[model samples]
Target: MNRSALTARGTPRRRMSVEQRREQIMDAARDLAVTEGFHAATLERIAQACGITKTLIYQQFGNLSGLLLAMVEREFARAAAGFTAARQRPPQPGQSGFAAGVAGVLEAVDAAPATWRMILLPSQGGPPELYERLDEARRLTREALVADLLAADPALASLTNPDHEAAIALLHAMSEELVRLRLSDPAAFTVERLLAQAEWLAKAMFGRRG
Candidate 1:
């Protein structure tokens, strides 16, 4: 048999390009970390999941910490890019820019449920490093959303820094909870359902009834 079919132990290994190999490794690591918790996603476990050697994984990602960082950064970048694009778009008629930005985020989550779930609903007992990075990403996202809101409606410009911070904190908390609910109980918290609630919240917060 050819080498591709000649493995003695298990499924035959197939050669992959560098990018393909890295993608495989990262995908395996993310699945393990999200389902079983980050600590459970040890080097050996990740390697086994990818049907590759630990050394191979190390070559691609340096170490366990490096792997975790890569996963976080990749996932967070996808999320950040979506929000950034939404914020930069011109407002639709009668639609608050904040609402449009939120719609963009919801659309992204709908498109890539796994990525958002990994970033939003981190596994219990996940690594501190993962949480630290996740928290920072979340903080930045909230700030960007708040900035978009302020830009869209300059009427709220008189608010002090303390008020702005408090408002953003509330918005962040609500968004996080909504994300968790949407993932865990999709039947009850469908995107449309959550977006409707979000619209109400946004209107109440911004006094932008149409």
Candidate 2:
């Protein structure tokens, strides 16, 4: 009777179980990861910041690798919604849609350099399993860009046809290049330069070239 009572009394009650708390921990880790670079994010640090024990993180997330993967996946979802899918649905038409799509990504790159930096320059050598997450979001974004361009100027639809696939490829290249430059050295280029050059590239490809 005494042993059972003692054990029961000693057992600590958790505010949130391993699973629920792990998500919270991961959420905190994600915000930190995006705020601070991935390299600076550590298990101990994240656990401490979350006000939980390190073992709880392991029990919930499986390990650093498991937690890291979850974090990357969440990041990819953000990219999908914020950069890619959103580009597909610009509220208006004409030049504004095209300009906004490009500008939106530029803003994200500036706002969350750590997020983009991880994609361009992965830390922790990266997880091989996560290889497709970024590409999937990026591919979707590229496709959205092409669709936006066509919508903005229906004239493009009538005058195409060296290759439909080529159009997709070109948009992908342009999006990637813009993101690359945005992430490369943001301070070097003014907003005007960035927008002007991007518009020029878009014009070169879709405006008159085709």
Candidate 3:
């Protein structure tokens, strides 16, 4: 028997690697941020939530700001990866690519509602850095969406004076609202309903182009 693996109390002490411990701390921080608010996700609270010492968290993340930033970046990257994978999937038969993309976004939201809520509907009192990062991500996403829209529909690109910026802004706002609604009240705002509305709008816009 490996006596070294057992605590003095005779129970086996669970050993977690540095990365595992960091993940535990980040998970606690994320849950606190989502359920309460970022203000509630203090080092003391996170340590208590994860049953760890605050000093350990400090050692792993350097400070509260670093911890928060790392947590947000991890979640954002995860959500982005999911969205990118969803977008790469082939569209269903008879479905327009735009509708398919909307469906993919909704699918990503459904997969991680908490992650989406943190990004899309951030709670007040979060650090300015958090909001700044979110703004940058949104800007990049909008730019990509604009490019995709222009490629998908030749008519949009052919316009002598296309207001793509304005159009993309409007679309982005609406999509964010729909995602927020779905996350806030999944039962009331099912993905199917939202996708149908988006598809209808896309069809209407494309119809006018013909």
Candidate 4:
């Protein structure tokens, strides 16, 4: 080939912006962490995954720990945003707010299976920061759910003497289990099926009281 033709062919088709490159690096790291454990998400491996040099990653994120931490923070923020958006949506007509919220959660999981997988079924051997972030996310989710439960069903919240704490714990556990099941076996535990069951359970529990 001619020199100019060779040069043109060798050049990248398009250049990524710094932010785009950072996102690409983070995505590669997240996929590695999800598929092969966090231990596999070293700078060299991430560079290989992104078709970039370790130096580039370092420029973007400072170091291996910085890259991983940034990736985790970005992913957690994404998942949290999804859940927040879902929660903000108004309930469908004739549907209890709780049922609507469950549907929203399933929809979020369906939209981002990889993100949900990392959160719902996190790989072992991750850094302590990862576990701490996960714990904080869980606590925040539980607190939000409790508040939603109280607001959605004033009857329950206004009971003569309700054990709101225990009820909230049970609800949180059930929601977490459902998400885990969906992540583990998506085909077997489809969103529609799970949502139907949740709705049925909710109605069964609250029908007489309503």
Candidate 5:
């Protein structure tokens, strides 16, 4: 075997590439941000969390702001994908789509409350680029929801002017409202209660049949 190949196999293989390594760094940053607030996430801290060097982080992301932007973007995408997936879990024969979707969202939110909080409420010290990336992510999330809606209700297409933008706004609002609830009462954010509330709200919002 070549020296490189041997080295690749000699030590435990790193599960991620350079780009993915950066992602791991950001994931750690996100965890810190959620738990300790954005201001508390530092290069040394992130490097230590990833068991890598600050130099590696600097190589991938220019500085702290760069890291924050990456973390923000990644967190948004993770939440969006997770919630979408949870909403789509296969039902047991006759489960309501609305209920399933609501449960999925709640599950996703539970999966990463800290990350969701950061996205829903970008606080002081967050980078400008983070805001831009989040804006894009928000738009993408909205687009995904619009597609889901159009697919579920083809008859609605005849309306000619479905307020997709409004729907997105409402969804964002609902997400933030939930975030506020969590902030108001950490105990109330328990997975089961939050999911039940989300299920009820989603059913009412979508007019889903029982």
Candidate 6:
């Protein structure tokens, strides 16, 4: 038996690599923040959840805010990739890339509700800084979506005037509300039904041009 393998209590210590350790800590923090409140997932709680010391967590992430910011960055990157993939997918007959993009985001939420909720849902008692960061990310996403919409259907190019910002805001708001409804009541807001309604609305707004 390797003498160094066992602890003083004769229990084997799980020595994770640096990356693995960071993942474990981040996962613990995310799970706690999502399940409980963000404030509840303090550094101590995260450390405890991951069976690590608070000092180790600090060493890994510098602070609780640092850990949270990292989580936000990762989630945003994932969402951006999902949006890009949906837009790049070969368009289905009678389906615009914009519609596909919307569906892709919803599908991602279905796949990872907790992760999406962290950004989508209102953070009641979470740090104001967190909310600010999320708001900025959302703003950037909306701008990107507007660009994609114009690219997907060149007709929309004419709509980009002084009041275009308001239109984009309204469109983004509507999509977000639909997502919230789907997440809140899946039975009432089935993906098929939502997609159909969205398609209908899209046709009504833009007409069957292509």
Q: Which numbered prediction scores highest in lDDT against the true structure?
A: 4
Instruction: List CA RMSD, all candidates.
Output: 3.9, 6.7, 3.2, 2.9, 6.3, 3.9
Q: Model 1, 1-210: lDDT tens per residue?
A: 565575667677567899998888888878887777777888998888877789998788889888878877787788778767756777568766665666677777778787888888788766577678887887787777777776776777553333666776787788778777877888888777887787777666656324
lDDT of 6 by residue, 1-210 (tens): 586777898888668999998878877877787778787889889888886789998898899889987876766677667656655665569876556767877888788776777777745676676688778877877887788777786766444243556766776777777788887888999988887776765555555434
lDDT of 3 by residue, 50-133 (tens): 878899998999999999889998898988887687567566887766667778888898888778888888898876877898
The parts of candidate 2 lying over 4 Å away from their true place are 1-52, 84-97
lDDT of model 5, residue 109 = 66
Residue runs of model 5 more than 4 Å from their true location after superposition: 1-24, 44-53, 90-96, 154-172, 179-186, 202-210
- Writing each residue's lDDT as its tens digit, candidate 2 over 131-155 gives 6776676676667767776777677
Which consecutive 10 residues in model 6 have the weakest lDDT in total? 156-165
Q: lDDT per prediction?
A: 0.76, 0.67, 0.80, 0.82, 0.68, 0.74
lDDT of 5 by residue, 1-210 (tens): 345434454864545778778778888888887777778798888899998889988889999888787677677778778877965775435444444555566667666777777776666666777677767876776666666656656654344345645754686567557656765576857655665665565445555334
TM-score per candidate? 0.82, 0.69, 0.87, 0.88, 0.63, 0.80
Model 3 quality (TM-score): 0.87
User: Model 3, stretches more than 4 Å misplaced?
Assistant: 1-11, 157-162
Worst 10 residues of 4 by lDDT: 1-10
Of the candidates numbered 3 and 5, which has the greater TM-score value? Answer: 3
| Residue pairs in collision within model 3 | none
Clashes of 3: 0
Q: In model 3, what is the error at residue 65, expressed in angstroms?
A: 1.4
Candidate order, lDDT descending: 4, 3, 1, 6, 5, 2
Residue-level lDDT tens digits of model 4 in 132-156: 9999988998899878866887777
Total residue pair clashes for candidate 2: 0
